[model samples]
Target: MAPAITLAAEAPKLSSANTGFMLICSALVLLMTPGLAFFYGGMVRVKSTLNMLMMSFISMGIVTILWVLYGFSLAFGEHNSLIGWNSDWFGLSHIGLTELWPGYSIPVFVFMVFQMMFAIITPALISGALADRVKFSAWSLFIALWVTIVYVPVAHWVWGADGWAFKLGVIDFAGGTAVHINAGAAALGVILVIGKRVGFKKDPMRPHSLPWVMLGAGLLWFGWFGFNAGSWLGNDDGVGALMFVNTQVATAAAMLAWLAYEKIRHGAFTTLGAASGAVAGLVAITPSGGAVSPLGAIAVGAIAGVACAAAVGLKFRFGYDDSLDVVGVHMVGGIIGSLLIGFFATGKGQSAATGVFYGDHTFTQLWKQCAGVGAVLAYSLVVSAVLAFLLDKTIGMRVSEDEEISGIDQAEHAETAYDFSGAGGGVVGSVSASALATAAQTKKVDA
Candidate 1:
């Protein structure tokens, strides 16, 4: 019989290399939240840019506090099959600094903070779907509650040692199901409750700034190296290196495929399309990178890129306003990544299960993947819808119509993303121009 897993009882010697690597990786993952902010913010119209950015930024602050309090405990600590808890880790008390997590080289605190970054970003991903319409206060409250109720349990299920999916032999290398799918489903549910954005298909709601989008995408790509590779928890493992290489390959392939699709479908290949494709690739490869070969990564990326590009249009046909294609890119991409594992997983490396494509035709792993995806999708959607409904009835979920059209930036935050007043020049230059025009008019009248 396999030896039973046990906690690290002895004071294990700290590996400086592993600790430093994780610390760096943790910083990289944290950077993705702001990267997400810029990505979502740029996709929004100028009127709603600040609000979009704030939604992502707020998660950083809110989830960090929650994670420290009990989020970490509920996710990683010992508990029942569904969830986990340890009062000792509350506020990170009693846990010794020198102690390592079970079967890991890194310290418990490092892992806590690393996972904490994941918690912060998942709810933020949902905000993109409800952009331009959601009330800031309502969003803040939702983040706090959703992370506790929805995110915590789901994190446990996928990542926790005793969680059902983890125990059931599901292989989510990172967060294809938990983070992306969960956020995507939640976004869909909340939007269904809140209804469509005011303009829907009628308005020309093009992204205000593609440069910002490119920059954000760039940051996300850079940070994802850590997000995917760092999940290995130690740099010494060869798997981490493979994951890192696969991440880049899949993302690149996905971007190219998306561009090709855009060229074929539309007359021109747009920059925005390329950026979105890259993100789709990133999302698709995230869960599969650890298990799949480089060739598999390419396949995953290319498929995700094309699929998500197609899926984004569903909002228009279906009459739901997923403002920034969160459902398309995150939800659909996540599912693609998760399910593809059933076909592409080699069973030769880090993940020991053989996919059907590799001659394991029982489809056992496929069913497990489906279960993880279905469970997360169903739970997140139901809970998010309920939360949105309750908040709508009580505190009002959306801004007033006037607030939305006139500019959510000013109405919600009393500020705008850009200051156009001095754009013609400085304030003095505008004043001087006005004075010159007045003088010319006066002289004309005298003549």
Candidate 2:
């Protein structure tokens, strides 16, 4: 007003081709939810299939709503290192905001919706590690709290306009450390606190369906093109094309490595193993892909596959039942990718700050990466714990023993997924029946 109320000039417009590309990328990412459903559904008992599917589907709804409200602004808005306190709920009412942010072709609001999908899937991915137990109310609350407390800050720290890591030149082209490693550690924390499911090591808790897992893997793989490629903000850039190539290269390598490992260790490459391997590869290359060469991505994928395989067996050693090995795949994969960038990433003049394999400032890059890992892990763990504590104290976490004995689908949702032959119901079927059977035998022996 003092300056005559002159408005800033309108933002420049992106070409139509670029806008089309971004929209396609957005749609591709939207596919990840169903892919996630298949991934988790295959690992869980048949009795809890619907419950597992719901965990992923629910995220598509809850996170989208939350993202529109404040998650996006908090995550991507123009605030400081820790968090963004700009734009109240849905404050970004305009479209095609190129003047404010030059690189993106799409409106900030559209970009927010697109990234919202990422925020949704990352938390849902962790749910795999907690399958078959945990109340829906509690699960919903856990996710809501975890995303707000752990995910938003970590996301801002890594990708926000004022993120310190971005300023310090930590190249996370996608989200190796932020989404994969962050979720993996948080998964471990929650599983530790909640304890194991009823029949963890002793029971033959094999996946009820392998086809579902493969399907999920397939879906996740397809969607990753968007997850990695979309990071470019628009398709016009060469970096975006490179990211697309890396996504494919890493996923394929991970698949081959995982199958070979399974063939050696378990005597056959199971469908579940293949699906898991693909995901592991995707996680590993997320942070380093666009910055590195094809060879680098392959190396990253191969090592991530092997390392995640080894880590998955740690459940027997460390005694923390990471029910679906979220800790193994995502955490280890993220670490591998984060560390690999030190040895792999190079520019036109690789001589100046070259990786060790190229013989330069390799060790320095690795050290910075480790620091970032430590910060993200510590922050996620502590914040997740605090949030879990608050929710538990305030509204109560964990279902009752009775609910525990029954499948969450029936206990929490008041419905069962498959009533194949009128055998499944609220209390007289599936998990409930199993619990009752166990109780009756115990009573008989005692009597």
Candidate 3:
């Protein structure tokens, strides 16, 4: 009897510990979208507050559906250099429950859901740049199209197994390039096409709620631990632990650096500056945390905090109205983090890649990092501009001047974030009482 052909190797076993860990990580990443909503919502004028929150919240709905439908296939299935596809990934219908994700101990489903959270937030990041004036329906449509055309393809390029960047040895530990840079570039593109907010530099556009910004930043800081560490796929190695440590170290350093810069440059360490600095630090450490030492992480964060603080002022000089400094913070921070990897990568960490400062004598890794960053920035900027231009010409991307002045929440959502009708017991309350009396008189006359 032809000795039954023995299986070549034992099937990969599932680790319940890793599975449970990934599930929690997925939840944490999902929390970031709502965190982002509060962050951006508080930064816009009160008139557009609810619209701002909806812009981020709607991404959770739109991207989740797309990820399940065909997004996972395009981003992570069988691949070409630019994109991926597999018939089985449609609607995630064909994935088996116990199938492990390649070398990881967790199930493929866990990996897919974890990635879905990332996809949801990338476009949401762009919403901050287009705040106050975009039509909600148009913005929703943009999320659908942008995720398909920009985000999915970029995710494949940076993270897919056969992606050109991945094969070319770009080390994006999390998503400095794929998520932040892509979203930031797209934000720049769309804003250029849509024109500026009505007031732009002329208006006194300031954050309405510092507390909301702080709360959102706090949530983002907490959730980012999962975002940075979980990219390692498992805690079997010490890399995830290192990433966790680096995340905290980098964020603290960045926050302090930003406050120092603010005190020196503007003579005040503002709460807005602290919140913005912490976010800048989070962005900078995202891609490099796994490869850098704790000390290196502090350097990355400090640099990003100062650089992003400076960059936020450029929107005025350059004539772009980036309502929330999305380009300044996310784009600049992503670039700083991704490039610093070429400088600070230790051969001892996640991979064997060493940077210029860590024994590598050549600029090869730095060049590769540049290529990845440049390609993503250029593609996202151009394509997103085209998408916005087309939408503006066809269905219209902006609200009317009348609607914009009246407030996007009332124009688009028919809801208000806060109620002032009873606040002072003044004109609004008198108007309400008069309206109620008029209604009662009309009812009596009809009877």
Candidate 4:
């Protein structure tokens, strides 16, 4: 009885406040996946809407199961620098209910679930670039593999206790390197292997629904407070508050900058531009928010907004078909954000590291940031390309050209985003099979 009493007394007292806060934050972060579904869903052509939504939705399902089984272990378990594992972490079977994450007030379960949400969304982000053409089965398999191969290692490198990058003093407040950059680079790699969409530059592939895009952007903005501030793991300090403020400041600044750039370069501001800009700002602030002041966040956001705006157009010049600008926005935004940390860090936020603008005259932090970015970019690009190439040669990554033209939703999922049959509209289910075939043929001819 005395020994048990002594052990209990020595155990860290659990803070209900922190636990509740993290639960709410985890819920918020989970919402971002559905938000991303709408974001990506609305960006693709109507023919591919449901398929696009499914791509994001499927990750939620696939990753949840994997996380419980071995994903969490590989990402956060105690192990080597490159990867982590503990047999007990498998199935979360060995963790005690009251066992707090070391140095934190929340239980290991809360932290694990929160990190799981990140794992779910990262691979989903890749689906955006392969929007209209990839086989759904192939994509699901890719997510499973990519998470195991790419995401787990990178997450360990950046966030795990003994990760090489984390030990080296790289700063990734949320997931600029692990989530955004990893997904973006993977998107680029897969598209390169799978080749261009059937029509490529000759077709008019505008977004099908701007309202959905705006709604998605709004939801993502709402959820990101948790994604950023909650990363601090507790509200016991002013750092979480600082992160929260920087997220909003940077997002607004980026949106305005993107709109300004759009007006100047394209002679008009667009809803897509507004949403994309907001996201770019969000991405930029993700890695730097913990380290930069609100003012520095503005710089990060503005720079990312303008840079990503310019980058989205490069696919056309380079002749790669990124279906929805995933490469330009996420990859470019992540790089801009990660590197800017070297210039904007205040040495007072989450860590004591100062940036070039703040007293570090040696550019050491910048080089470190570059190294993190370069390593993630190179590894993800090469490995993802290899994965896609292998899948392409074996099971095939793309649907047939006819299926793509006819609509991936029908061919892949046998469904559509909207039903127009009741109103006598000419959309999918409203028409006879032969008529639908004719329309598909017409679309191919038009393209």
Pick by TM-score: which candidate is best?
1
Candidate 1 segments whose C-alpha is farther than 4 A from its true place:
1-12, 422-447
Which candidate gets the maximum lDDT versus the true structure? Answer: 4
State the C-alpha lDDT per candidate. Answer: 0.90, 0.78, 0.92, 0.92
The residue ranges of model 3 lying beyond 4 angstroms of the native Cα positions read 1-11, 422-447
Error of model 3, residue 254, in angstroms: 0.9
TM-scores for all candidates?
A: 0.94, 0.87, 0.93, 0.93
Q: What would you estimate as the lDDT of candidate 1? A: 0.90
lDDT of 4: 0.92
**Which tens-of-lDDT digit does each residue in 1-447 have in candidate 1?**
001255558434578898899899999999999999999899999999999999999999999999999999999887887989999999998889977777676788888988998999999999999988889999999999999999999989998888989899888887999899999999999999999878878899989999999999999999999899998888665988999999999999999999999899987789999899999999998889988999999999999999999999999898889999999999999999999999999986576897889877999999999999999999999999999999999999999998888988999899988885656457768788999999999999999
lDDT of 2 at 228: 88
Query: Per-residue lDDT tens digits of candidate 3, residues 229-269?
Result: 98888888799999999999999999999999989999999
The order by descending lDDT is: 4, 3, 1, 2
Q: Provide the lDDT at 208 for model 4.
A: 93
Which residue pairs in model 1 clash with each other?
none
